[model samples]
Target: MIKTLLFDFGDVFINLDKAATFRELKKLGLEDFSSGMMEQNQLYEMGKISSEEFVNFYISKIPESNSKKLIIAWNSILLDFPQHRLEFLQQLKEENKYQLILLSNTNDLHISWIKENVSFFTEFKSCFDAFYLSHEINFRKPNADIYEFVLEKHQLQPNEVLFIDDTQENTEAAKSLGIHTWNIDPNTEDVVDLFSTKSELF
Candidate 1:
């Protein structure tokens, strides 16, 4: 029985233009990251790298002006999170169907931007029994440990939780531990669509 719902916050809720962000950075001369940056990015997601270190590492490779421009361009991908998603989550909270927990890989800058722009963040997050973030927990997805941490922390059996994320590899990691999962593609799948479709799912 699925008693809990574990959600990933990035592309599942907020739109992420990763490809566009990297392209913008390259245009501004942040070259080193052009090839192997995701490897370093995995470190960030794993909390192996500090936000400052992550930014500085990239900035170190670019000219001063281009570095500043790259930072602006990179950070600009964080767009608005619409209220409809929040409303959907809120409705689920009202239904009291499952214990909601959110697990996300995020950083200080992305968070700071949300606090400044997404006013419903607090309310939306309140719906969750636990809200886990990589930077806050010093752990991340695609690592078996993080999945284990959540499962054990919540005393949740893998079959009792459904993990929703936009990343395939991350979902696979959760599935390895027996958790149910959904790889939400915002372009194709709306979270609201899940509630109806998943009624008889489990």
Candidate 2:
């Protein structure tokens, strides 16, 4: 009796070139992110640091790179949002079978870019009953606290919510808390085939 559908944003709805950012950053003379930079990334994702601070950190590291170039390189990972996925979500919303909630590990810059570029971003957002972004909530996936926050906030039973994410670690974390999950592979699995792929649960 799944009463809720919890979804991830990137690699689930919108396409992403996961390696694009690193590739772009390499052009800016950043060969790799040090441990501190990785920590800063998580901090930025959780909204602990402002976007200005984020860009400044990169600029400080790569003196030759300007703010504009750093921002562009950071956003290079985001690609397209296919229309068919939106239609499938719209149909699901119309059916009103289960509560749809979007739980995404996203930062401010990425979201701002989507808002400006994705024409149907508003419509896509409207489909969800509750939308939770990592930066807004100060909680990112693969963290038990974030899952607990969502479950507690929604007053949902862990067993009744199906969490879908492209990352195995995220899905596994949810599953540990008694939630159902689909550890989808973006390379082969399309979210539009949810029912067919997880038929028994449906």
For model 1, what is the error of residue 178's alpha carbon versus the real structure, in angstroms, after optimal superposition? 0.8
Please report the TM-score between candidate 1 and the true structure.
0.90
Candidate models: Cα lDDT each: 0.81, 0.97
The estimated TM-scores of all candidates read 0.90, 0.99
Best by lDDT: 2
Minimum summed lDDT over a 10-residue window in model 2 is located at 24-33
Model 2 stretches with alpha carbons more than 4 Å out: none
Return the clash pairs for model 1, or none.
none
lDDT of 1 by residue, 4-29 (tens): 98999887777777677767776776
Q: What lDDT does candidate 1 reach at residue 162?
A: 87
Candidate 1 wrong stretches, greater than 4 Å? 32-36, 66-68
- Tens digits of per-residue lDDT, candidate 2, 1-202, equal 9999999999999999999999999999997889999999999999999999999999999999999999999999999999999999999999999999999999999999999999999999999999999999999989999999999999999999999999999999999999999999999999999999999997
